[model samples]
Target: MQENQIDHLFQQGFSLHQQGRLEEAQVIYESILKLQASHFNALQLLGVIFLEKKQFIHSINLITKALQIQDNQAPCYYNLGSAQQGLQQYEEAIARYDKAVAINQEFAKAHHDRGVALQELQRLEEAITSYENAIAIQGSYPEASWNLSLCQLQVGNFHAGWRGYEWRWKNSEISKTAGLRNLKQKLWLGAESLQGKTILLHAEQGFGDTIQFCRFTRLVSQLGAKVILEVQPSLVSLLQNLEGVSKVIARGDPIPECDYQCPLMSLPLALNTDLNNIPGVPKKFITCC
Candidate 1:
């Protein structure tokens, strides 16, 4: 096919790619590659489609070939890094991200994903730095900020971590999975006095998180509030008699009337908890379940 014809086909494929019609885009990109095997754009884009499709090896192969055709493309390097990351090749992904940032120092996404790759390998400090770099470039980058908070918490920087944990609400995926409550009551993040108030402490994550953080209900009761604990259906019976809990109910049960509410996970931040002052059931309060 003529160069102009190939260019037209590439434009169509790229348009489809931008529209998220991956299968159609892949077909056009493949057709372009068949006509002109050395087509850099086609190779790179098809690789990206493969990456999106979760065909990591095929993505790696095609993107590698595109890099061979033109090694200086920053986006290609970033996409290659993404493919590597998807395959759990953390070290390789980091290397690719490094190359991308070397080509474009202001590549906030590259820096953020490099942090993710490092974090996957349990390199917390390095991941923190990379996430910070991403935030520095793109001040409004929520994912990087959120991940940085998690790393900080893992490293015992509870205050900073919990402060950043508030960013989780800004993430759509987390908000959906956590089942954000649409209550009329105010969200109590320990900023307001809970004195004489009725508060609902609801589970936001998994059963494990619910169990671990439910201890905060005692602290809430200590604040002169009536604590109503909401947990998974299975744990409702187990935690019904927990100290400081005036009521325990399954998640799907009707929410009782309350003046304020908080997620169990956010209780630490709400109560100013730290490593030195983490709240838990006292030995005297422990009972045989």
Candidate 2:
């Protein structure tokens, strides 16, 4: 009978999870947990479910309870760190990730996650090293590489950061990796003379990135080229006067043929931009999402 009840609880939880109702699934997991405190699966599931729901404290509590039952569980520590990250408890998250890495030095994810927490706390250099360690342990995790590049760029390592930042284009979220109607596909690594070339630079990722990279439109134009920038529609009017930009093309227009293409974020590295060389922009690029 107890086994049947546990099975039923699991089924309910799985059904709710499949339907994307994490809160409801958590309640069912909690009910099963009350009857069987030592249920490891329920414990871990509830912890992760709560984490996904952004109930940071509750997720920490559930994971910590799991840790008490099984002190050697590396995943619990990792999950605990993730919960702490959501709560913006950087120090505690670092401690939890430290324990997880100590238990399993080869745990690349833990190192990367700790780096994210450190980066959030403004420990940029330390975060870079942590990301490097993660790369050493397991090379080329797209998320880690993307984040490492951000930390690098934040600290003015434009050369290295921009090179590494290219990995972001491969992320599944980037929809235009496949060829568009008429634009040529290229990495934009300081190549393809911008002189007289009609370069189409397509934007990728968040609003901040578009704004941040928009400064390059002027740079590209300075090279004696026509710039057709494909950016977010909302940013169209805002980017009208960015330096050197010949045209702002938001969606729906037939993509124009260009001699070259560049990911919006790739220009800084291609140009070897630094603190002194970093292009200044107006209020449009300065604003955040």
Candidate 3:
């Protein structure tokens, strides 16, 4: 095919990709490679499409081909890192992310993703640094801030962690998953006095988190507030035994009238929790029958 014809096809494919038509874009990219085997853009973009499709091996191969044609591009390394991450090759992913950052020091996403891989490897301190670098580069990066908070929390740095944890509400994925986006009620972020107020404390993440943080219910009550604990149906019976909860309601049930609301995970921040004074039950909260 003529060079102009190849360029036209590439443009068409890129347009399709921008419109979220991955399959069509892949077909066009494949067609471009058939006409010009070393087409760098086609190889790189097809690799990205494969990555999105979760075909990690195919993504690696195509992206490697693109690198052979043009090895200096930061995006190629980033895509390679993503493919490696998909295959659970976290070490390899971190190396690739490192290369991407080395090539382009302004690659904030590369730093953030490297932090994720490090966290997966249980290198919490290194992961925190990586996340902090990303945040320093892009102050408004919610994902990086959230991950940084998680690493800090894992390392028992509750003070900095809970402050960073506030970014979770700004992340679209977390907000959507927690179903907090549509709620019009104000989030009680420990700034308000709970005295004489009916506070709705809702479950946010998983059963483990709910179980771990439910100890805060008694603290809220001690502050002279009525607590309505909304939790997963599976935990409703168990949580009923928890003290200071005025009522235990299952998730998806209609919430009663309340003066304020907070997510379970946010309880640590609300109560000014620290590692030395972390909340705990006197005994096991649950006893298996």
As for candidate 2, its clashing pairs are 218-243
- Per-model TM values vs. the true structure: 0.94, 0.78, 0.90
Clashes of 1: 0
Please list the residue runs of candidate 1 whose C-alpha ends up more than 4 Å from where it truly belongs after superposition.
Answer: 281-289
Candidate 2, TM-score vs. the true structure? Answer: 0.78
TM match of model 3 to true structure: 0.90
Q: Report the lDDT tens digits of candidate 3 across residue range 64-138.
A: 999999999999999999999999999999999999999999999999999999999999999999999998998
Q: Tell me the deviation in Å of residue 250 in model 1.
A: 2.5
Q: How large is the C-alpha RMSD of every model relative to the true structure?
A: 3.7, 5.0, 3.8
**Candidate 3 weakest ten by summed lDDT:** 280-289
lDDT of 3 at 7: 96
Predictions in order: lDDT: 0.91, 0.81, 0.90
Better by TM-score, candidate 2 or 1: 1
Give lDDT tens digits, candidate 2, residues 204-235.
66678788878777877888889888887898
